[model samples]
Target: MTVARKRAILTADSVPMLPAHVRLIFNEKRDSWVVLAPEKILWPDDISVLILQNCDGARSIGEIARALSKEFSAPFSEILGDILEFLQDWSDRLLIRLAEQSGGKP
Candidate 1:
């Protein structure tokens, strides 16, 4: 019998990081950023590059959104919503994972 692992649930407080099998790199030949997984490559646009670069496993979703909002002069709410959706999509694709909680709280 096989147990299906549950997918991670993303939230405002979730700290996103690239999984061990995933990497984000600048493809010089393509002159763009690409996400490399075991069997897949994703070419992200400029805005997505900004978001992916900030997923350092240390900042929460809210923190990232706040920084992006300030950098682009966009509204916080809009940025947050976009970030949440973006992260969730990547998380579902197994490219990103939520960092383990530091404290004893789950």
Candidate 2:
């Protein structure tokens, strides 16, 4: 993570959501959902699509990662860092936001 990214305040309770200009849409042609923004479209792979879907303003990063791990039969630690890095990258691009909340650290 960059210095600026490290400066971001992310925690277990911080809810993440698509930006106002970004929307999640199903692409029937591709049989997947995509992140649609004003100037760009993100076609994430199967796992990534699920990750993005879980970014709704309800589940925390920690909660999402935990649930995804069990659902996918993967280890929590294996996906935790990647999930955080993915969210932080989108947050940096203004495509997503980690809403402020007080709780456990991710």
Candidate 3:
């Protein structure tokens, strides 16, 4: 018998981090940042790089969105929506994981 693990859902309260098997590195040869995971390599755009860099397992989704919103002077709701979608896509690929939440409300 085989068991499958359930996928985690991303919420405003969820903290995101790169999984142990995954890494984000600057590829000197390519002159850009790349996400290295096993045999997979992904070249994310500049904006995506900013978002991924903030996935330090410390900030919740909401916090990240707020920071980016302030930095870019964009609306919070818009930034939040973009972040949620971006993180969800990466999470589904097993590149990102939700860290254990510290005591706090979303």
Best by lDDT: 3
The true-versus-predicted C-alpha distance at residue 10 of model 3, in Å, is: 0.4
Question: What is the per-residue lDDT of model 2 for residues 1-106, given as tens digits with 9 covering 90 to 100?
Answer: 6565444655555678776688889989988888889889888888877888888777888899899889989998777777888887787787777655223221
Q: For each candidate, C-alpha RMSD in Å?
A: 2.9, 5.4, 3.4
Question: CA lDDT of each candidate?
Answer: 0.87, 0.76, 0.89
Backbone collisions counted per model: 0, 0, 0
TM-score for each candidate, following the candidate numbering: 0.91, 0.79, 0.91
The residue-by-residue lDDT of candidate 3 on 1-106, one tens digit each, is: 9999787789988899888798999999989999999999999999999999999988999999999999999999999999999999999888888887323221
Candidate 1 lDDT, tens digit per residue, 28-80? 99789999999898999999889999888888999999999999999999999
Candidate that beats the other on TM-score, 1 or 2, i.e. the better one: 1
Per-residue lDDT of 34 in model 2:
88
